[model samples]
Target: MLPKPIPPQPGQESVWDYPRPPRLERTAKRLRVVFAGTTIAETTQGWRVLETSHPPVYYFPPADILPDVLVATPRTSYCEWKGMAQYHSVRVGQRIAPDAAWSYPRPTPPFAPIAGYVAFYAAAMDACYVDDELVVPQPGGFYGGWITKDIVGPFKGVPGSWGW
Candidate 1:
């Protein structure tokens, strides 16, 4: 499925565009991200990853994850579309991944659908796989744009992309 409100009247080539669907697209692309020390959070709503800028932050249902040991942090960030997002640190035995996980406690009007879903940074994760095959991490550090084999060279993850 897709999100609602539709996309800009069409024809507009803005970076912040979405193909809203009535329901969330529960793709077969579901994968697991294991951090060095993060625990997944199982919620009634589900696992939602809250991050912003350009791409729509990916949210995974709680039942879809195995959050055995992650620690919540006081860190937070604001997004124009979503709202305020909380942070978490995962601890697997002795190692710990700081702010490896994030969620939106209170989202704005448009993105209330993804209240508790969580998404882990592909770069911070030890490994992410869709069933059997491992997925490549999207190039940017701050942005989680996973790099797949099909993706050609030259990817940008900045605010004002100059020549990207």
Candidate 2:
């Protein structure tokens, strides 16, 4: 991506060769969120997918999501850079995706921007949308940002962008 401020180091490599996401000035326009699939399995906060070698992760706002639908799980994972991430389970109809979503209650300093946040696996969702347009999940079990008309790709999980 054009605005990739730092280049990929040795092992990190990079998925950016096109352009970086638009930077914010602390007051960026809010992108509308839309949920699809059965039971509207989605995060309330608008999530941005940062394309990487790993699967696309959907970041959500704590307040934006329906509170009753989620249940805190005892599971936890630690990321040296991102800090300790907490897990939560989602219940939809007869289906229950346990620990399918995660959050950072107390993230490391650098990742504090994502504090009190949650993320979901793209594959776990039944349906999702942004505005009137529908969203298509990126393959390889990825779910970064919602696919919209404004965004262009060579996106990962779409087709040729696999292994991205």
Candidate 2's residue-wise lDDT over 1-164, tens digit each? 22222354543324443323321112122433322434443333454435433222446667767756678999988866567888877776566777767888997775566787677654456655544445555554533444444444444555454443
Q: What TM-score would each prediction reach against the true structure?
A: 0.63, 0.58
Task: Let me know the TM-score candidate 2 reaches against the reference structure.
Answer: 0.58
| Alpha-carbon lDDT, every model | 0.53, 0.53
Regions of candidate 1 where Cα sits further than 4 Å from its true position: 1-25, 36-56, 149-154, 158-164
| Clashes per model (N, Cα, C within 3 A) | 28, 15
lDDT of 1: 0.53
**lDDT tens digits, residues 2-89, model 1?**
1222233333222233232212333444456665544243223332222212332356665666655557899888866567988877
Root-mean-square deviation of every model: 7.9, 7.7
- Give the TM-score (vs. native) of candidate 1: 0.63
Model 1: per-residue Cα lDDT at residue 103: 76
